[model samples]
Target: MTEQRFREFKMPDVGEGLTEAEILKWYVKPGDTVTDGQVVCEVETAKAAVELPIPYDGVVHELRFPEGTTVDVGQVIISVDVAPGSGPVEAAAAPAPAPAAEPASEAAEPEGRQPVLVGYGVAQSSTKRRARKGAEVPVQEPAPAGTYYASPAAAIQGELNGHAPVAAPAAPVAPAGGARPLAKPPVRKLAKDLGVDLATVTPSGPDGIITREDVHAAVAAVSAPVAAPAPVSRETTPVAQAPVQATPVAGARETRIPVKGVRKATAAAMVGSAFTAPHVTEFVTVDVTRTMKLVEDLKSDKDMQGLRVNPLLLIAKALLVAIKRNPDVNASWDDAAQEIVLKHYVNLGIAAATPRGLIVPNIKDAHDKTLPQLAASLGELVSTAREGKTTPAAMQGGTVTITNVGVFGVDTGTPILNPGESAILAVGAIKPTPWVHKGKVKPRQVMTLALSFDHRLVDGELGSKVLADVAAILEQPKRLITWA
Candidate 1:
């Protein structure tokens, strides 16, 4: 009896060593044909929901776990018959289970690391504790490329943190220069689905990498409505993409929801941040009639066409300007060294309420972007979050954040600081209220702003100034021109 070769698709460590993930869904079943780089299953991690892509072209032999089962990283979740023509399913699958029989450590590092794209590969250096300016930042040398990932989705997917990308079965592509194009597996898959060539798309991502936005832009240039990657509905906040609870217990009025995945991660992080950091919240209510008018005017402006122009856009811009003026407030507490880490750049985080839970993903280098650029980014960020497709890389390195409780019709909230972030600003609902304006009582659009910060890192005066600046900008709507 000859044995057939089966490649076991193990649960990948999608987050930075996130131990386990619950299988949210499976797209392919036994006997289903799967091609290289095709998403076969979706898994929910402590951080985010990620789609697991099969690496090799083959037939699915078996699914080891059912939906909602939490499997440890490196455990075999599915087995694929690489040599599918050999025999029957039962016979082929029986001998093929050897791949899954191996220890997890062996499966994760069986031969060596696989080849990966440049920017999507392991991080070289990350900011850590520093005693002085001269101290060397820790760096991890990239493993020699040429590794085959057990699952490509596990390599790059995370809920609220960033991690490196893994290998894909597709050939590394480049333009006329012969240099390989840098892109994540998901972006590559999107390009393939839309019939857009990654090499032809001009990359707007940092380090000359192609992003999902770049792929969508390529489709936009071709003007193919059918080939567009996402929906036209622009929702600024996260909505329930999937049901949080399924079948209820028999004869029980209360359906118990298991606390795991994104909710579990969120709970733990919130508790840690609350206790670890000394929090102080400050509030200011200001008339934003001018800001509201600016939003309406921008909607008709040609420069702002096709972008998400709303009160939130102006609010985010106001917060950014505030951070610029109070740069010290845009810093983090380095507990390891007990030193203040002042950041020169800003990764502005937007707190979105999703069905999975509250997840905050940030825009990279937000300070350098122009207002239109910021609007475009905000549109993309919200659209991505609403679809539950936000990547781990999008959620990392946030220096500050903005939470709009106004979406829920709430006045304001004392938002807790995101881990490693110094401050969070909450915007309340905007409504017409009786106010004293120009020496007379009149009905005007007004809203309250709440600023919460790590009191250890940000002083009362600094936090107050940041909140005051944001309110001032919204009041005049012209300070954005002078301040920004």
Candidate 2:
């Protein structure tokens, strides 16, 4: 009789050194047949939501955890039956063989070559199960040789039994006259977390699947009209309708959002950068009338058509040019090596405020890109960040950053350095102001630029040179061509 074998798929380290990820979804369930490289689940790491593909082709035997469960790397997340048919029929047809002698170590090294999948590490010799507290059941003796067992627990006891595990029953049916709400696992988890019933919420997604927006809309509907009590009758005293006040329950007036994910990582990096590096901020107010005019021209230009053309784009180009001229400013302090690491290629990070939190996703080799390419990269970066799809790799190895407080209508402020980056440039709102252009006072477009740098790597002279170069480029827009 052919023996059926089951292979366990472990939770991989999806991102660089990511230790854990929350199972955001399960695309394949038990009894479902999956093929190699087929996406089985979507997991949300601290970096981003990534879909995981199974490396082996088989029938899914079991899912280790439900959606929203955080699993550590190297943990088995699913089991698959490699040979589905070599179970009851084969076992009953063949003669039973005597059980082999047990080895001193339970985990015997696997024979032959191990299957290697990129990103995911090689399969281990044996799988280890996490002990469940108070849920431990007596270990059942291995089924007699040639017998088939469907349970994962039974399969794990020995390889003699290898039938596909039975699929779990479907969830309870919805109330009469309605079907269970169709939603992605993450959306369902979000609705559950917000104390929302998916059945009651209207679905706005394609094919009636509930979306995050739909769940939020439902919450808003419930929270709206807080003062729904009948209006005071004219019988007693006609009192003006008072604003409804939400009474605190259990003295909890403020909602505490747990700091995690991007927010938590940002806070840690900011605190570390702030204390570890000596920050010196230098501000310069520049007359950017020429730069603003250039921006308009670029918007109308055939080359720049259909691309995002704004003050930020020009400002970013100015910074890149400045970095090129004052290359010394683009460096990082390596404390362990006691050296200043200068970068020839610039990964220009743009600070974006996302729904999740502030994330600095950078454009790789921005210094090499043309104006149009830079604009495209910037647009893609901003859009990806806004959608919370920025990956951890995109946010790494940044040489410098630009935070545009100008978009928020702020004049100027000292910006904090992103950890490892030597300098950060903050662009303020560009407004029409009276400024001396060629020794004549005129209403010209003006903006403030602030450059904050790590004093260890970028001294006052270098920081000032970089900032001044950017300012000069903005003042005289033709410098970009000459400088390039």
Candidate 3:
């Protein structure tokens, strides 16, 4: 009989330097045939949700973990049977019975490492069943001859000692009051991080599964009373009453969001940027009357038809033009090298708020793109971001960013510089306000612009010039043609 060989696929570092990812979904299951380049699962990293493709064509043998489990990099997540006609036979045969541990002096060494995809490292060691803490060792049952074992550690150790391999014990059952809370691994991790007991959290998901929302809701219920302290008489306050409300109270009085994924990463980046970079913000109120008129004109223009032509488009273009006039503003502070790295090309980032969190996916080569091309790219970027389909690669290498707080009718904000980028421009609401137009008070389209930059790399003079240039272009729409 031909020996059927199985290959294990390890979880790779999908994002740059990402050490772990939560398996959000599984596309292929055991007994399913998959081809090379076929996506097997979707995983959520700190950066984004990415689909992982299988590198080898084979019949899936096993899925090592259930969906929502956060797996470390280089850990095997799936196994595939590669030998021809092995899948049917393997499927037909029942799981091998547990083998009795027996002693033998001569055993074979473990199999050689299998070929893996590029950027994916080999597994550190053969898989082993972790011994449960404080649990009694399970008794091994003897197996019939030629029974295949599942665990490589057991198989190798058994072979080395010339004994039959032992099967791992079934997972322990939860004591009374139904099984352990049914939560996805990520939600469970979030609950653990927030010091929440899953048993106390009420499951809202279908089939009584605990969701991230449920865990967060439980946390909110716990902290709500503290947020609004109700006056209690010393005589009425009892020790037992204090512990009664430890669990989540029904009725939504508050919400506690467990920060993770994009939101968690954004928080860390913002904190680091705010503390590390000395920021200086400069504000300019521009009469964008002409810019708004130009936007209207562009909407009706033959070439600009079907494109997203708005105030943002004009604002983005104005910023690019301003950067061109003041080339020194397009740079980053390299602290390790103690130097300013001036980028010749611009990867302009647009700050987008999605359901997941805030992500800045940039347009590549913004300085090189024509007006229509820029509009198309900007539309695509916004659409992708809104759909939560922005990839990690799209968010990297941003040289400058634009945050349009104006969409929410805010006046303006001193925007924080995106980490590594020198500056970020916040656009305010454009309202018809009385302004000095040609030294005469007139109702004109007015907007506030705030530009914040890394003081280490950009001085007051350079920043003012960049902001002034942008104001000028917005005030006079014809400047785009002259400036270009």
Candidate No. with top lDDT: 1
List lDDT for all candidates, in order: 0.70, 0.68, 0.69
lDDT (10s digit) by residue, model 3, range 140-254: 4333222333322122222222122434344334425534466654454455434455677778889888876787788798663222122222210111011011223346464
Can you give the lDDT of residue 165 in candidate 1? 22
Question: Candidate 3 regions off by >4 Å?
Answer: 1-4, 87-255
Candidate 1: stretches off by over 4 Å: 1-4, 88-251
Clashes of 2: 0
> Mind giving the per-residue lDDT tens digits that candidate 2 earns over 1-484?
2223667788898779989776655665566788899878777677666678898888776565645445778877877777777663212111111112232222333343143332212233333223222223332332332232232222333322332323333343453444346775445545544545566777788987787778778768867321222333221111212221222224445533435455667889899999999999999999998888888788899999888788788888989999999899888899998999989999999887654457778999999999999989987886565445577889889999998777656889999999999999998888899988779999998889999999987888888999999999999989999997
Q: Give the Å error, residue 257, model 3.
A: 3.3
Q: Return the lDDT, model 3, position 235.
A: 13
Arranged by lDDT with the best first, the candidates are 1, 3, 2
Models 1 onward score TM values of 0.70, 0.70, 0.67
Screening candidate 1 with a backbone cut-off below 3 angstroms (N, C-alpha, C), the clashing residue pairs are: 47-159, 48-159, 113-147, 114-146, 114-147, 115-146, 115-147
The per-residue C-alpha lDDT of model 2 at residue 349 equals 91
lDDT computed for candidate 1:
0.70
